[model samples]
Target: MKKIRKKAFEPIDKEEKELMESIERDEWRPVKNIDQEKKKAMAAARNTLRKDKRINLRLTQKDYHQIQIKAIEEGIPYQTLISSIVHKYLNGSLTPRS
Candidate 1:
């Protein structure tokens, strides 16, 4: 009759198991620089206070080209000219006479 040998069972080590458990329970916190956060918040607040207004108007391509040409001739920006025109109209400097 042949004798059968039993295999030895090894238990898990306590220190290694606790280390893994600690790693699993670790919480992740975002790393943020205080100065960067402050700058971002300030920029956001400024943008919120600075509103962009737009208007829709119809103009011929030739008229737009002419305005651009005139602005270039006067060494001024087209949008600056438009803003000045609008301001003048609002302040009664430019009046329409019929």
Candidate 2:
């Protein structure tokens, strides 16, 4: 006989509840090539996060102050904010509000 158990916290949504129920029923199985999959995922994560190059940038005083203010509002460093903006623009996800 198998013992049933309840989780400390409830699932937050219908999809989450279904996933939790399936997991509790032992419906999921481990991947066969787990080590290889782990290595590939790690490599992809490293490539995504890599920031190995640097460049000297010039900005007007007003632009610099505005960037700093925006970064502070977003709770990130100004350099990170600039990097994110550039990345989003290159990926075609950033657009002017107007």
For candidate 2, lDDT tens digit of each residue in 36-80?
999999999999899998989999999999999999999999999
Encode model 1's per-residue lDDT on 19-82: one tens digit a residue. Answer: 6566557844555797898999999999966638877767799988898998898899977777
Cα lDDT computed for each candidate against the true fold: 0.77, 0.96
User: Which residue segments of model 1 deviate by more than 4 Å?
Assistant: 1-51
* Model 1 residue 6 CA deviation in Å: 99
Highest lDDT model number:
2
What candidate 2 gets wrong by more than 4 Å, as runs, is 1-32, 96-98
The Cα error of candidate 2 at residue 59, in Å, is 0.6
Residue pairs of candidate 2 with colliding backbone atoms: none
- TM-score attained by model 1: 0.42
Can you give the TM-score per candidate against the true fold?
0.42, 0.63
